[model samples]
Target: MISCVFLATCFVAIVADAHEAHEPVVVVDSDAMRQAVLAWRSTLGPELTRQASFEFAGPVRTDWHFVPKDRLGVNWHDMNLEQRRAAHNLLRIALSSQGYFKALAIMSLDEDLRRLEASRPNAQNVRDPERYWFALFGDPSSDEPWGWRIEGHHLSLNFSSVTGQVVSVTPAFFGTNPAELRDGPRAGLRVLGTEEDLARDLITSCTPAQLKTAMIAETAPGDVIALPGVEINFGEPEGLSAEEMTDAQQALLRNLLDEIIGNFNAELRERALDELEDAGFDKLHFAWAGSVEVGKGHYFRIHGPTLVIEYDNTQNNANHAHLVWHSPDNNFGADYLQRHYAESPHHQSAK
Candidate 1:
C-alpha cells in the first residue's frame, strides 16, 4: 500500500488567492511543475541534460508509447539518488496522489512479470521497475509553451503547459500485464481494477435491449482500437449513449468517468470534467466487447466528440490490460499551442 503520509509530504498543497475569506483556493500548481523540472534538469547536469532535453516542436515531443523499447530521455536506472528525488518531485507536482501511486504500482508490476516469466532468458532484462524514462521538451522556465513526459512499459503520462498553466493532459495511458496477480505476496492485486470493475458494473447493469445495443462485438480485440501514432477517428461512437441510459446508469457512468479523470491533479480534473459537460454528456457513448465477466477477454470504450477513453483486457487469457485517455484536438496541447503561437509571433519562430 502507498503511504498517505508520504504523499502528503511530497505534494504539499499550494494555495492560490481566495475569492472570499472562508474559501481559500488550492490547486496543483503548474509553476511548481516548472520549478521542479528546472531543478531536475539542473540535477541532471550537462551530459544527461543533452539526452533528456528536446525541441518542443519536433516529432520527438509526440513520439510516445507505452511499450518497452529504446525510449527518449533519461531512464530511472541512470539517475542518482538526488536526481531521482527531483524527478519524483516533478511527478508529484504534475499528478494527483491517486495518479502518482498508480504509476508506482504499475511500475512495480514489472517485478511480477519478471518472476512469472522467469523461464524466458530476457525476462529479467526487460522487466524492470527502473526502466521508466523522464524527458522535457523546451524550457519549462520560459514564457513559451513546453511539455514533459514520463513513460515506460505499461505507463505513459504526457503534460503540456502554456504560460505557467497546464493546458493539456492527454494521451495518458496506463496498462498492466497479469492484470490480477494470482499468487505470491501481492496476490489478487489489480492495479487497474477500478477501471475494469466500473465498466463491468455499467455493462452488467444494462437491460437485454441495452446490452444488444452496447455490445459491439462477440469477441474482444487483441488490444485497444486507438494505438499510439494512429489517427484517432471513430467517426461516430458505436454504443449506448448516456441519453439512452437510466438515471441510475448515468450516475454509474459518471462515477467511472470520475475514476478516470481523478487520475490527474484537481485543476486538470475539473478542467476535463467541464470539457466533458460542454461536449454534451448526453452524447457520450459506452461500448463494450466480449464477455462481461471477471478473468475473461473484454474491452470497452467511452467516446464522444471531444474525448476518448478506452480499456482492454484480452491478452494472456485476459490478464493483460490497457487504459487510455485522449482528446482529438487538444492532445499535447495542439489546439492550445496553435492559438498561443498565432497570438505570439515570437513563439511561432521558436517552434
Candidate 2:
C-alpha cells in the first residue's frame, strides 16, 4: 500500500509538470519582428541607424522620474499569453519607426536596457529585456498567468496577460522632449510630425460651437495626471461625439483616431475598434487645451466609453510632445480577470 501511494504521488507530480510545460507561451514571429525593425530602420538614414545601434548598446543610465526603476507599471500585471504577444509586437513597431529622431528613440531604449542590465548583471537586464521586461513576469515554467512592464525615462509601455491573452496596454505614455531640433548635428529634425499634425488638424477643423465643447481648460495640465502609482478615474466625456458630427466631420475624427490607434497592427486595432463601436458614436468626446496656434504649446483629449486618448505638445515651445491611449474596461487586462475569475474554483464557491 505504501509503495502504491508513493507511485501515485509521483504520477501526479509528473502530470502537473507536463501540464505546465504545455501551457501557451507568448511566441513572436522573428520574421514579423524583423520586418517591423527594418521598417523603422529604413526611416532613419543609414548613418543615423548605425549610430543608433551603437548608442542603444552602450552603457548609460537614463533618469527615472516618478517610478522606481525596479517597480512594474500598474496595468502590466494582468495580460494573458496572446495579448502580451500582440502588445510586444505593437510597441516594437511604434518605437522603431523610420527617421533620425525616431531612431534615436529606439537607441535611447537600448541605452536604458544596458543601464538596467549593468545594474543587475546576473539578471541580464539589457535593452531586449528592458524594452520587453513586462513579458517575463510570473512562472516562465508554470501554467499560471503572470504580468510584465516596460519602463524608463520618457517611455512606459505596460501590459498584463493571463493564460495567453492581453488584458491591458495602458496607461501607455510616449513622449519626446525635443519634438524638433532647432540646432545640433541633426539640425531641423522633427521626431513626431505626424502625431503633432493630426491633433492640430482635428482641432482646427472644429466649428466655434464644437470648439467650445472640446476646449476643456485654457491651460495645459503640465504633465500626465496619472503617473506610475496613481489610481486613475475615467473622467466624464466632455467633447462632441461622432454622432454629433456630419459624415465629413466623422471621417476627420476617424482619421485622427486611426493615426493614433493604427500604431498597433490589424488584430489589435480591430479589437480597439470593436470596443469603440460598442460604445457607440454618441458617447465620444473631444477636449482641447493650451495654444490654438500651431508650433506652440497645446494639448487635446478624446474620451469615449472604452477609449481615452491624450495628446500634449506644450513643452520646448510646443516642441515637446506626449500622448497616451487607454481603455477603462481593458486597462491591465480587467476583462480577462472577469472571464478568468468567473471560471475559477474560488468564484464558484463564492457564488
Candidate 3:
C-alpha cells in the first residue's frame, strides 16, 4: 500500500509541475461540478454506484451516439423527483446557462416529436428526455483521473478530468428535430438557430471564386460527418480562408464561432478560442453544402487544426438540425490519457 501511494504521488507531482509551467487552458468549475456529482452519488448505495459505473478504459466510454436509445447508468426515469433535480443541477453547473437552456429546449422537442410520431409502429417510447442517462467512469476522484457522460436524444456531453482539472469535453454534440416549430407555444423556436443563420450569411457572401473552393457538395449530409470516438479524416480542408474575408464577413465568422463554441462555460470557451487563435483564423476553412435557400437542406463546416464544428439541417425536410464540436486531438480524455500514460508506462487501465 505504501509503495502504491508513493508511485501515485510521484506521478501526480510530475503532472502538477507540467501544469504549473503553462496557463490552465482547460479550466473546470470543478468545485461546483464535483460537489454536485458527489452529492448525487451519496444518495446511491454501493449496488447503485456499481450499476451506474464502468471502467474509464471500457467500451462504454466510447459508446456515444446522437440517436435516442436506452443507455446504461441511472436515467431520469430510474430516479425519483429529487434525483431528477440533482441531475439537472449537474447539468446546470457543467453547461453554460445558454447551453443549459439549449439543452432544456432540445429536450422539450422530444414531446413534440413523440406526439407527431406516435402513429409510427413501436416508436412511441423513442423520444423521452427523461430517458437520458448519466454514468461515471471509474470512481469519482479529485486526485485521480475520471470521466462522466450525460447523454440522450439530441444531446451528448462527455467530460474528462485528472485530479479535478478538466482536460476534455468532446465529441460534444447537440441536435434538434423540427428545428423550427411553425405553430405552437414553441412556434418559431430554433434551438440551433444562430449556428445556421450565421453560416448561411458567410456562405452566401462567398465570391464566385471563393464559392468554388467552399462548396464541397451539391447536397448536405443527413447528419454531422464526424462519428463519435473516431478521428475525422476530412482530408485537406477546402474553403475560403479567414484571411480572405471582408471586415463584415469576418465579424460574421467570429459571431458564428462564438455561437458554436460559446455553448460551454467561460473557461471552455476561452480555451477553445485560445486554440483557435493558435491555429490562426486564416487557417480556418468555411465549407458549405446543399441549397442556399432558408428552410431547405443545408450544411456547413468550420474546419481548422485541432478544431471542427459541423452544422447540418438535412432531415425532417430540413427542419431538423444537428450541430457538434470536435477536437481531433482531445476527445474521450485523450489529452489526460497522454499525460497519464507518460508517467505510468507500466500501468494498465482497469479492464
Identify the leading candidate in terms of lDDT. Answer: 1
The full ranking of all candidates by lDDT, starting with the best, is 1, 3, 2
For residues 1-351, write the lDDT of model 1, one tens digit per residue.
233223332332321122224563259654777788899999998989999989888898898899977698999887888998888888867777667777877888888788999998898889877788998988887887888999999899998887678889889999988799899877887878988998999999999999999999999999998899999889989999999999999999999999899888778899999989998999999999999988899999999878899999999999999999999899999888888888886787443
Which candidate has the top score in TM-score?
Answer: 1
- For candidate 1, the per-residue lDDT at 127 reads 86
What are the models' TM-scores?
0.91, 0.63, 0.87
Steric clash pairs (candidate 1): none
The list of candidate 1 runs beyond 4 A from truth reads: 1-26
Residue-level lDDT of model 2, residues 1-351, one tens digit each, is 112123223443554675678854233442343343334334445543333231111121111232224433222223334434444454544332121124235324333334434666543433332332222333212334433345554555544545544445566666665566555344454545676776677778888988887777888877655554555575677767777776777777787777666555444555677778787866777777878887877888888888788877876567767777766676666677678777773532211
Name model 2 segments beyond 4 Å from true: 1-135, 140-142, 346-351
Q: What is the lDDT of candidate 1?
A: 0.85
Instruction: Report lDDT (CA) for all predictions.
Output: 0.85, 0.53, 0.78
Span of 10 residues, lowest total lDDT, candidate 3: 1-10
